[model samples]
Target chain A: MTLWLSMLGEALQAMSANKLRTFLTALGIIIGAGAVVLMVALGQGTQTAVTKSISALGSNLLIVRSGSAQQGGFRGGAGGLPTLKTSDAQALLDLTSLNTAAPVVQQGAQLVYGPNNWGTQIVGSTDAYLDIRDWTLQSGRPFTDTEMNSGMRVAILGQTVAEQLFGSADPIDQSVRIQKSPYQVIGVLAQKGQSMAGSDQDDTVLIPLVTAQRQLVGSQFKGTVSMIMAKANSAQQLASGEAQIADLLRQRHRIAEGADDDFSVTNMASIASTMAQITGMLSILLGSIAGISLLVGGIGIMNIMMVSVTERTREIGIRMAIGASRKTVLLQFLLEAVIITTTGGLIGILIGVGAALGVQRFGGIAVAITPQPILLAFGVSTLVGLFFGLYPARKASMMKPIEALRYQ
Target chain B: MSDIIRLAAIKKVYDTDAGPVPVLNGLELSIAPGEFVTIMGPSGSGKSTLMNILGCLDTPTSGEYWLDGENVASLDEDRLAEVRSRVLGFVFQGFNLLPRIDLKANVALPLVYQCVAKAKRLQRAITVLERVGLARQVNSLPPKISGGQQQRVAIARALVTQPRVILADEPTGNLDTVTGQEIMTLFQDINKESGVTMIVVTHDARVAHYARRLVYLRDGLITYDGSAADFQEALA
Candidate 1:
């Protein structure tokens, strides 16, 4: 134990004597580890952001839309037939497997309040829409079922639309013009930031379904809706809920046993898993690129160690003559190499985490600095040093005392 | 006193492209305990090879080398290192001190290999340094000291292990005449006061005179083995 301690002391002294050379030798490892840590953090942060956005869309939610239809010789794309109706949404709510259901009619409109004007999507749905989407009003009350049935000209502004038209002022009770028709703002939705597609989720307006169909979309689409948003009782029930809804829709539409259903249902869980897989691949690719730099760093260590062995040949001879064994000499050199790489690894971690935070704070990139990758990088660097230092340490230890002593 | 070093029929052959080159051939020698012996020869005369064999740094090609009762020629590399650490000390002409460390650490090097505690190692190192009149220079680096002082530090390092035999190869070759004599006088004092076996290898007859017994080698064979006074008389 004492011998090993002395060896360590000797190794440290030797490294300190050539501080500049040691730092230069360790630079490659520093850059390699730093890049690896930062890349992983960014990837993790992006994954978290994606997950947050997906959950904000609502938990265990599924969107049911009308599929394509054939009109004469022309094939109409998704939501073309408008086979979904408010009655179908109401029927889904009766299923015990589903939590709630809302009939939706969506359209883009220019919203104007006084001189402030902003283009936003206008969504028309019943009071249950807020429950399905898990959204709560920042202030004011949602439109009641009575108002929805009566086709009242009342609106609920999204956080983005409210900011554009009202700034910091209270947007409740304010009048906004949509589709050239005046409506009273009843509520302001809380901020939801961006969606997974990078579009602003809060840039929208909401109103009763009857009001949208009668006042904005006209009475031609009276009983039908563009889509139905339904929530499952639990995450595990989402698949069953989609199956039950599809089977019911097929039966209700009276499609033949061999014919295709005219509606499509999408589960949010599948989309989230796919996004997670993509981020996982991205992190692996970044980690591999950083690994190449670590390889180069190992080569640098080997090169410098070889040079050190040659420079200290006479010193090895003297130590051997005095009583140092081959093991002792090897340990000394190996310890020096480990010290260099370990120190470099520590410094790189600090710089990488700091850079990640800087990017998060100033560059607007989400970055999460976790401990797993940091420990992994540190362990890899130390192993790299040991592996690269082996050959040189062996060479130094195997020197013949006579020849080494005579070496200039 | 029993023999501390014994070599019989020792030979050393170096393999080269031209074929085997023999440096030492069938050499025989022995030294009793507490003896001060000098091996003298010109370059390539195998004196250095003989010193290396005696110091346990190298084994003969085929021979029996017994040092202090154990046959060293049969020892493995690790055992040879153990033997060297426990039983022998070496002083070289160039001082061979590590330039980066202080004199005290340099002197304590052997004890470090022995796994001695730091305080005890430094204490023994200082004690030996004082014996060589280098107590004040313990903290100084080897490069900062003069040639004579460096040689003394080397001697102190050799002594710190408290080995039975001290093997020096051209111990004062790099020093001036006065410094060389000073180092030899220190060696003579160490041998007499401690009764330690000393083997000094050098080509300088003046340095050889400091040893009590002189052995001269020529082409790997010992040509003369006698008292130092008789060897001096023969040279005169």
Candidate 2:
């Protein structure tokens, strides 16, 4: 240990002699380490954003939207056909693989409370909507079971809708007008940030399903819904849950053999997996680019170390003549390289983490600076030093004392 | 006394692109413990090659070499370095003190290589420096010191290890005549007082007079090995 410390002192002394050259050599490592750390933070941030948004929609979900409509010969787009019904959503919970299911019927409408007014999408769902989305009320209570059965006009406001119409005022007991129809706001939803489609998730309201179907929308088909959102009992059972829903819906609709599904069963896990793949690929790409920079940095260390070894050949010879062994010489040179690279790497990591925080604070881009990436970057830089320092150190150690002393 | 250093039929050949160039051929010599000897030869007489062999910097091409009762001619590179550290001390023509470090660090370096503790080695270094009549400029760098002072520091470095023999290769070559004589006198004093064996190689016969014995080399052969006083009297 004392020998190692002594060698370290020697390394530091040697490096201190050529400050400008040392800084220039270390600059490559600084930039490489900084780039690696920063890229990993950004990549992990993007991944977190995707995962958060997907999970906010609901966990292990399968959204069933009406396939299409045929009015004689003129075909309407998907969601045009009123194939899904509120009862179909409730029936899905009977399967053991499935959990809570909620029916959603949405339409864009202008809301007014006093003079302030805003246009937002109004989603109508049962009380199970909160449980399915794993959401909570910021204040007040959800519409009761009694309100659902009698088609009462109780409402719950999303965060944006509450902010727009009330503007810091208590909105729980306020009456909001949706197209000249007054509804009492009983609860307010918590902030859910943004959805995957770049739409504000909290910029809307939730009203009872019966009130939307009968009082607000008043569709020609009495019990039709636009879609049914169902969650699996567990993430592991999502596929089976999706299959169960498809089978039940097909049996109830009484479709012939080999007929197209009247309603499409879209597994949300596929979208989640696809998003994960894109972000993972992005992380690998950024990491590989950073790896290339590290490689360049390692080569730079090798170049400078080779120069140092050549310049100090006589010094090596002198030390060897006095009794320094090959291993000691090798260790001293290797330690010099490691000290340079590690010091550069430490500074680079601090700067990278600082930059990430700056971006998060000023730019509002979510950047995660986890310890895993930081630790990995440090480990990689150390390895780079050892690998690149090896060749030059070996060259120094292998020198014949006589030849080295004789070298001018 | 048993011999402190012995060489039997030492031969050295260098493989060159031109061909194998023979430097030392079938040379034989021995020096007892505490003996002070000087070797003088014209350029290419293989005097430096013989010094290198004795100092363990280079191995003999074919021969047997014994130092301090150990046959080190066939020792591996690592063991040879150990022998160099424990058995011999070297003073070079250029002082060869590490320039970046202070005088104390340079003087203590051989002991450092031997894994001596910092405080202990530095203490011994200061003691040796004081013994060489260069008392306490421990923090001064070699570049800042005069040629004579640097040579004194080199001598202190050699003495710090307290080896069995001190090898000087043109140790005073870069100094002025007065400073060279002063350094040679210091070597004489140390050899007499500490009973440490000394071998110095120089082109100047005047520097060779400090040692009690003189060996003259010519064409890889020792032409004379006898008392310095008799040799000087014969030349006169």
Candidate 3:
């Protein structure tokens, strides 16, 4: 232990004598480690942000959308595509397999609440939409089934739309116009913020499906309902619900065997799994890119170490000829390399984590500084030093004692 | 007197670009434990080669070289280094004290190689330096001192190991007459007081005068071997 400490002291003294060169040599490694950690943090941050947004849409909700083709071939199967209708939703609701089922119609239009006008989406659905969206009325009551069935000219505004329309005034019972059609706002939804897809949930307005179908468009036969929403009783029952829904939808659409279904059913469990997989993959991709910089830094360490070996050739010879074994010499140089690179790696990890914290603290997005990536970068940095240091240490140890004594 | 060193018919050859050149040929010598001997010869007379062989830095091509009854010629390179560390000390003409380290560290180097404890090695180094009248210069570096002082430090380094013999290769070759005499008097004092056998290689008669015995070599062969009085008589 004392000998090793003396060796380390000597190495540090030697490096201190040439401070600028040593710092410059270590700079590459620092940047490499820092970049690796930064990439991982950013990747993890993005994934977390995306996952948080997706989870906000409620856990047990599954969405079914129209497939690419239609059974009737109307409008070249673009508009008349095979879709989930009101009947499919009712059927799922009536079954003991599902918890809740709702049909939806979506329309993008310019909304005018008093003098303030904004481009927003208007959704038409039953009262069950609030549960699927994880929303509650902020102040007033929600729309009733009577309104939904009778196609009443009553509306429910999302938090953002209500704020813009009414400001501090109560938006409930106030009137808002959707494309020249004035409707009384019966309720205001709680702020649900943004979805995982970057769409603002609070920036929308909702009304009865029949009102939207009758007053907004006069019911032109375009296709099946836009989408369907349903829920399973529990997470464990999700798979069974999915299987039952798929079978029921398949039978209702009456597709023959070997024919691909014309509709897509997206279960919440599967959607969450798919999204998590994508986030994980993206995180790894980004982390690997950072890993490349560390590799470059390792190469830099090796290159500079080679130069150091050449410069200290006589010193190496003097030590070896005195009684230092080849292994001793090799270890000395390797230790020096490891010392420089590991220090750089440690500093880089700190900087990466610090930067990640800074982003999290100041920036609106959440930043994740995971320990696994930091440790991975650190281990890789040491390996890089060892890998690069071997060649130079070998060269130093291979020098003949007599020739070393002869070297000026 | 105790016979401590012996060499029998030791020969060394170097293969150069020109061809093989023999440096030592059929040389036999021995030194008593407390003897002070001076080896004198011309530049190419192979005195340095003989010194290297005696120092255990190089091996003879053939013949038995023994120190204290151990045949050094049979020892491997690592064992040879061990022998050199424990039994033999070397002082080169260049005063090859490591300049990068301080005088104490340089002197402690051999002891370190011998795995001496730090405190004991340091204490012994100080004692040897004091013996050589270099006690005050213990903390100084090689280059920071004069040529004579550097050689004295080298001598202290050699003596710190408590070797049986000190090999001084042209000990005064790089010093002035007065400094050379001072160094010679130091060597004679250590030899008389500590009973350390000394072999000094020199070309100058004055430096050779300090040796109790003198050997003259010519063309890789010893031509005269006797007491200092006989060498003076032969020169006369």
Candidate 4:
């Protein structure tokens, strides 16, 4: 053990004596490790961002939209049949697995407050809409059920619309005109950022379904709804709740057996998993590319170690003559290689983390830096050193003492 | 004193593109412990080959060789290295000190292989360096000192192991006449004071005069082996 330690000391001394060469030799590993770290951080950050956006759509929620309708030989896309209704949403709430349900009516309208006017989505829903979508108010309160039933002109402004209409000023109790009809803004919704589909969730206004149907949408859409948003009791109940809703809707719609249903159920969990799969694959792809660079770094180490072995042939001979065994010589060179790579690995980690933080701070992109990948990179770099250092170290150890001593 | 090195009918052959080249042909020699002997020969006379075999750096192609009562001719590579470390120390013509490390570390190289503790190895190295009159140059690197000092450091490294024999191959070949004489004087003092067995291989007659016994090799055979004074008188 003492001999090994001394050999390690000798290796370190030799490396330090050629600081520039050592640093240059380790550069390949440094860049490789840095690239790996950055790519992983970005991948993790993107995954987190995607998950956040998906959850922002609502937790354990499902959306039921009217399915494509066939007219003669022409078939439309999903949500073209407009078969969903307020009664379907009401019946969906009766399921034990469902926490809440809201029938939705959506239209694009011009919202005007004073001199400012903005075109935005106007969604009409019941009081349960906020609870089902996991939305909270930034200020004031939701409209009463009496108001919804009475078709009163009250509105809840989303963060984007509120900013356009009121700026920093509070919009509560203020009057706004939606499609030429005056309405009182009851509350402002909290910032929801972007949805899973990459659309801004905060660029809309909410009003009671009856009010939208009676005042703006006209009587033609009185009984029907654009979609229904249903929340399951928990994440685990989503599939069963979706099944019960589907069975109930099929029966209520009086659809024939084995026929395509008039509505489509979209599970948010499924969308989330698919998105996670895509991002996970992307991370692996990036990680593999970075791994290739690490392999190149290992080759760089091998090349330099070969040169070192050749240059120090006489030194090795002297060591052998003085009593150093082949094992000692091999170990010394291996130690040098490991030290170089590990040092490079550590530096790479620092640079990678710094780059991640830099991207977060300056690029305005979310970056998650975890310990697992860092440790993995470190362990891989050490192994690379061991593997690449082997051939050169073996060559050094196999030198005959006489031939080595005679090396010029 | 018992014979520390015994070689009987030892032969070394090197395979080359031309054919097999025989260097040492059935050579026989023996040296008792505490004896200082010099082997002198011209280039290609197998003096270096004999030194290499004697130092366990290379094994004879076929022979019965005993070193310190062990049959070294048949020993494996690892055991040969072990024997080299424990029983023999070598000084080369070029000093062969690792230039990056300090004098003390260079002198302590043998003990590092022996797995000696750091403090004790340094202590022994310093003691030997002082014996070679290099006490003040312990912390200096080899290149920072003169060639004579570097050779002394080499000698100190050889002595630090307290080996049964010290083998030197043309120890003063790279030094000037005066430095060479100084190095030879140090070797003479070490041999006379400590009774350490020393075998120096050189072509210089003045260097060979430092040894008590002189052996002359020609055409892979020992032409003369006797006291240095007798060999000098015979040459005259």
Question: Top model by lDDT, which number?
Answer: 4
Per-residue lDDT over B1-236 for candidate 4, one digit per residue giving the tens place of the 0 to 100 score: 27999999999999999999999999999999999999998899999999999999999999889999988998877888999999998998999999888999889888988888889989999999999999999999899999989999999999999988999999999999999999999888888888889999999998888988999999888989999988888889
Ranking by DockQ: 4, 1, 2, 3
Local accuracy of candidate 4 as per-residue lDDT tens digits, A281-337: 888888788888988999999999999899999999998988888999999999999
Q: How large an RMSD does model 4 have?
A: 2.2
Q: Which sequence of candidate numbers ranks them by lDDT, best first?
A: 4, 1, 2, 3
- Return the TM-score for candidate 1, rounded to 2 decimals: 0.95
Q: Which ten residues in a row have the lowest lDDT in candidate 2 chain A?
A: A67-76
TM per model?
A: 0.95, 0.95, 0.83, 0.95
Model 4: how far residue A212 lies from native, Å: 1.8
lDDT of candidates 1 onward, in order: 0.90, 0.89, 0.80, 0.91
- Model 3, position A87: C-alpha lDDT score: 81
The sequence of per-residue lDDT tens digits that candidate 1 reaches over residues A1-408 is 887898997788888878898899888889878887888899889888887888999888999998887666787899888888889998998887899999999988899999999999999998888988889999999998788999999999999999999999998998999978899999999888888788999999999999998877757678888999999999899889989999888988888898777889999878987888888788778777777788788889999999989999999988888888899999999999998888888888888899999999999999888998899889988998999989999999999888998899
Where is model 1 more than 4 Å wrong at Cα? A95-97, A110-119, A174-184, A257-260
Q: What is the docking quality class of candidate 2?
A: medium
TM-score of chain A of each: 0.93, 0.94, 0.81, 0.95
Q: How well is candidate 2 docked (DockQ)?
A: 0.74
Compose the digit string of candidate 3's lDDT tens values, residues B18-76: 99999888898888889999999998999978887787767788888989779998677
Which 10-residue span in candidate 1 chain B carries the lowest summed lDDT?
B73-82
- lDDT of model 1 at residue A65? 94
